[model samples]
Target: MYETKKWKSKFFIVAFGQAISLLGSHGVQFALIWWLAEKTSSPLMLGISGLVAYLPMTLFSPVAGIAADRLNRKIICIVSDLSMGILAAVYAGLLFFFDLPVWTVFIMLCARGIGNTFQQPAIQSIIPQLVPSDQLVKTNGWMQLMNAGSFFLGPVIGASLYAAFPMSVVLISDIIGAALASAALAVVKVPELEKHQLEQEPIARQLKEGFTVFQADSKLFYLVLGEALCMFFYAPLSSFYPLMTSDYFNLSAMYGSAVELAFALGMMISSLMFSSVLKIKRKIRTSFIGLFGMGISAAVCGLIPPTYWGWFFFAAACVCLGASGNIHSIPLTAYIQETVAPERMGRAFSVLTLISSVTMPVGLLAASPVAEKVGVNVWFFLSGAIMIIITSILIWYSKMKRRHP
Candidate 1:
């Protein structure tokens, strides 16, 4: 319908606005986490909070994907943002009126998660339509940059707002952001998917068709599984990073900021490199390189003790993990965009999100207790070992089959 220049221009407009909204949403997320931590002081409650936020996405993302394919994605995205804004407003109003329990906040977060469920697949499905195939990797890398930028700045802003203002105010800020996002999306012209009779089939059957694409390309299936394994190994390491930084390395709470900053900086650097320098043709091989780098850095971080140079080593590992991770994810995403049939992309991406998460919840549930028993440092080392082992197997298998993310 349009040339690369036109689509690219529209893409930037949408992306820029979405990035602004993302920053606000992330800020509110951290604010709520900090608020819950301050109020509950119960690890059990905090853990439950995490579960409530993520589980809905895992459960309903496929359904959301189905809806995205069936419905107008532009409308879906706008409605998602506006709905979140309304919910945030109402929730904030309730908090202002009376002393709402922690359960209320958790429930609201679950709603936010559901909003994300619809929004994420819709956006992913929309991206390929917005950019030329050759530019997918560059665009994906830029998206990663926006995410990393939000991650780096959101918490700081959220913490500051939380400290200076009330919870209601922080929530209201999220609403403003949501409104801005919706307004931006409201203007973008998204090309519609042409409908087919098969799409009108039963939901269960439609979903089955989605899964059947992987059978058509077993390499894609294997690629998704390999990434799933990476995500699984990453769970314990990510969840317990603060604990390891504080307890294992004798770093202060503030020191965790430096570690996170290092990761963000790495992501930014990788994003820039991907956009310019890294023309990653062997996308699968690039992902493997990243996996190996991540595994080695994580292992080294775990093995190092709290000596004078401990912080330096830990910071370096975090940077490597973050940079390599961006390198890993960009091409895989671009590969999916390039490879999958346009008609089935929504389901394909949703399935990837779904199957790639098979172990993460399990990992999250098990990590705390495992770390307690084995020591947090030990947990990191174990995750790194798992990563390395899995990557090695994948590499050998790929070589044997001459298959490729």
Candidate 2:
């Protein structure tokens, strides 16, 4: 119990630091999107900026993961934060001195994505070191809470800052937050794992090993496939929801705010449930149920007609998505941490990140065209349906294996 308490303390500290950093980053991102939209009035530009920011994580994650496996994970974290901070400062300078063009914003966003390619894998891999195996769910709950909080607070703070000052000043907040995150990491003491010293191995061989692990483990394969599909379909809500609410429903900016807030609230509530109330004998079963529920709620929200009543349903659906997502992610993360050897954690996380990154751009690209051709409502409906179908197939497969075995 004493050891558990100590681990919890460390976990909270790291979670807190990350929460702060994420809050600042999310705020800056939202503020920038709004700024660009107001300045250019072009959805295409916003889509381009989004693409630039996310595509690197998909492309570079494997390399970053290998670097994490071969080096000090803490150092990787520090370097990534510092690099991102520098980029944020540069963005501020551009906004201050020159009329920031679309290309410039895209370039800066790409730089940040490159930095995150390193940061995300290192961070995900390090969580296991900070908590006990049995406490993985609780620790993950806190992490989800931080995630939800960032989404909840970032946009409001960012918009407020942008209103009160110039974009340069607003961007400064991210720099400061990143610096603080680096400092927090510096102070934390984590048990160091031996770096993979197989320097003679080709990068291709190393990457192949990471993929081999996933391929060999049928459970992991299904889990990853489910995760990738969910990300691919679910990501569009972030890009298209504001337009949907404002244009389709003919609601005010307040409606967009409400939608975002509702989503965050759902996440927050679900995190709490996972930590405090929900319990399951089988983690896989719980994950399947959560994913299925999220899909169902999403589909229902899409099908409902636009009205005040529909807004409530949409908010409810958002809550279901958040809760179910947290339930699925916590176990998946813990399983990876436990199953992978310490030295390989970095590479494992990197591969996972790579899969996530690769899928997101595809998802975004798909969302825009689908929204244009069919309508955002249809897109949402189809995406949700896909999630449900995919999850059902995986779950059925898992059940058959269990019965046979």
- The global C-alpha lDDT for each of the candidates, from Candidate 1 onward, is 0.76, 0.77
For every candidate structure, what is the RMSD over all alpha carbons to the true structure, in angstroms?
A: 2.8, 2.5
The backbone clash count of each candidate, in order, is 0, 0
State model 1's lDDT. 0.76
User: On residues 1-405, what C-alpha lDDT tens digit does candidate 1 reach at each position?
Assistant: 346668877887777778778878877876786566556544445556666776777898789878878888888888999899899999989988988887888799789878888887788878887788989899888888877787677667776787788888898778988898888878888777777886879989878766787777766666666777876767546545655655576665346556766777788889888877779888877877787778877887788777758888888888888898887778878888898777777787778667544455666677656766677777678778888888889877878786433
lDDT of 1 at 76: 86
TM-score of 2: 0.92
The numbered model that scores best in TM-score is 2
Clashes of 1: 0
Q: What is the lDDT of candidate 2?
A: 0.77
Worst 10 residues of 1 by lDDT: 37-46
lDDT of 2 by residue, 268-338 (tens): 88787767776544665666677787788678767967786777677677767767777777767767776
